[model samples]
Target: MKLVKHWIEKIFATITEGIVGALDVFFSSLQKWFGVGSMPYIFVLPNLLIFGVFILFPMLLNFVYAFTGGTDFFPNRRPWVGTANFTRLFECQNFLVPNSCSEDLFWRAVFNTAGYVVAQVTVMVAMSLITALILNRSIKGQAFFRSVFFYPVMLSPIVVALIWKWILQENGLLNAIILSLGFDKMPFLVDANWARFWVVIISVWALMGFYTLILLAGLQSIPADLYEAAKIDGANAWQSFSKITLPLLMPTMLVVLVLSLIRAVQVFDIVFAFTGGGPGTATLYMVQYIYNNGFASPTKQYGLSASSSLVMAGALIVLTMIQLYVRREDV
Candidate 1:
């Protein structure tokens, strides 16, 4: 076994050395051909090309399409209608409400999305951080518990949604359990408020483990010596955590926050599968609305869908920028 291990190490080392030597020679040649400054561009060109083709092109097309009444493909004869899509979207009202003046469905979707983002992100990040902190400490069977907590994260979102759907259904496990306890069978996914509640709850449950793993990685990256120094200075657990752990963990926390915020704002699969936009559009998130407008509905409002997507993307960008700015000031 030792001999096999030694040979394996040698083979891997040789292969790595060969690759490194090849890369060195290739770069040297490239520098000679394109000059030293241009060599960086050569190295970056592949990724730049891919990003331009996949991300930039699609975004540019969407922006253009938002201004035109186009279907799946761009209309050849349609004239440019400046801001009409945006205007129509703003003026649109909920289908169920005939005379309600203030409750525009688009605005409702935006508000609901904002609320969902705030609630779920807060709960997910805080719970994940606490879980990470606990798991980072010395504990028995830490690996097992970590895996158990993170198992939900490994499952597909569709699978998670399906399982939760069944669990939260009227006659599902939850109601069965509640009935057993002599309590009324609650409508977890039927009532508007209750449906939204379960959506957020299930989202948190499905995502907390993933965020916990990320925070745990960050926690482990924190040097033990810092904790030791805090201990020597007579810092209690809470004091040390507040003064040292949190400050050090801020960068990772910021990353988790941004990611969670993005996911929350763009949430679709669970919302689609669980509520299908709802007990009367109560849980209709922005992405789901976009999906409904672009594809699911009989009257395909492509322009409106594109406009909504652009709006959602812009909102996310602004929020992310604000978060980054805050993080920078903290640093």
Candidate 2:
């Protein structure tokens, strides 16, 4: 075993050294032929090409599609009707009442999605921070607890949603338990309010571990001496945490915030797997709405879908800007 390990390490080191040597030679050749200034661009060209091909090309295509309306698969053949799609998207008699809007389902999706973000992010952050704080303490079986909690994060989103679906169904484990306790079975997935509630709860349950890991990393990075100094000054746990921990953890929290917000906006798989936006579109969100319009609906309004996508992108960009400004101000 030792002899095999020795040979394996030697071979791995040899391969790594060879790769480094080749890169050095490649960069040197680039500098010789293309000038030192062009070397960075030369090295970055592959990634730039990839980004252009995949992300930028698709984004530009989507933007262009937003300006054209039709059921035609060929984009060029589709007639241009500039701003009409967006105009229809925002055509609302009463924005507050989704039923009064021209695109009622779209407005309903927007409203539901907004509510989901507020509830899910709030719960996710709070749970993650609290769990991370607890786990960061000198507790026995810390690794075991951490792994147990993080286990859910490793599960596929579809799998997580399906598991929760079984648990929350009418004749499922949870209702069975409730019946055994002589309590009325909950309409977890049937009622609008309950469906929305469970959607947020399940999302939080599936996602908490990842955000916990982030906050844990932030917690571990905090200087221990700050807590000690606070202790010496007769400051209690709450004071130290509020004054030192929360402030220092703000940057990581901001990262968590922005990422969680993006995930919340893009939430579709779990909701789709569990509810299919059912109980009269209770759990229908932006991405699901986009999917319905673009592909699932019989008419397949690609233009409307593309326009909605652009609107969502614009909202996300604005949100990111606001978070960045807040981060800078906090710093």
- The TM-scores, one per candidate, come to 0.80, 0.86
84-122, model 1: which lDDT tens digit per residue?
Answer: 888776664554442342326677788789889988999
* Top candidate (TM-score): 2
Q: Each model's C-alpha lDDT?
A: 0.85, 0.91
* Per-residue C-alpha lDDT of model 2 across residues 1-331, encoded as one tens digit per residue: 9999999999999999999998997788879998988878997899999999999999999988899998886798999999999999899888999988778888999999999999999999999999999999999999999998898998888998899988999999999999999999999989999999999999999989999998999899999998998999999989998999999998889889888998898889989998999889899999999999998999989999999989999888987886787667556
Best by lDDT: 2
| Model 2: CA > 4 A from native | 1-43, 323-331
lDDT value, candidate 1, whole model: 0.85
Query: How many clashes in each candidate?
Result: 0, 0
